[model samples]
Target: MAMVTFVDETTSGERRDALGLDIAEERLALRELIRRRVLEEAPDGDDTDRAYDRAVEAFGRNGFLVLVGDRQIEELDELVDLGPRTEVVFLRLVPLVGG
Candidate 1:
């Protein structure tokens, strides 16, 4: 299994191998990555299903950006090849008009 680092800008949190996903596979889907992230960071005792749904919605609304290394992921179905030292960054996107 490969290890990956996860970084969240929304909560300013960072973790190594947070979800324990099997990076041994040739590729992984963005959806699975988002699901794992939400599952890893969701508050204890909260409904995981709801949290996952919210995360997916946030992705659709451009609430955040998922970057693998320096490359931005644009689709939920996009497949990413994992490396031993891959770093995934989830950056919250702020709406400028709201300010």
Candidate 2:
């Protein structure tokens, strides 16, 4: 499975200043980055790889998916205020077969 996480904040400049990343560009950039990573991780041309490729592409093109979650909570601001310690994770979701 693959996990990709990001904080949803309005401070585009702050994200750029703190992480040297432009949040305004992140929505697209991050998705592409995730797609590339998935491809790199699963280059064997298998179903899993194909699924991940489609997911990452969708995330990049659409901006959301069942496996991806985005939260805009003011309370979490405290965590970001604390500093880089705050991090988000994105994991791949797959259906379970037999129990």
Candidates' lDDT values, in order? Answer: 0.77, 0.37
TM-score of each model, in listed order: 0.78, 0.28
Question: Backbone collision count in every prediction?
Answer: 0, 2
Measured by lDDT, the strongest candidate is 1
Model 1 alpha-carbon drift over 4 Å, by segment: 10-22, 97-99
lDDT of 1 by residue, 1-99 (tens): 556677667534543344444466657899987777677778999998998999889989999888897799999999977877777887887677756
Model 1 residue 69 lDDT? 79
Per-residue lDDT tens digits for candidate 2, residues 6-42, read 4333222232111222222323334454444455455
Instruction: Give candidate 1's total backbone clashes.
Output: 0
Q: Could you say which candidate leads in TM-score? A: 1
Model 2 weakest lDDT span, ten residues long: 73-82
Alpha-carbon error at 67 in model 2, in Å?
Answer: 12
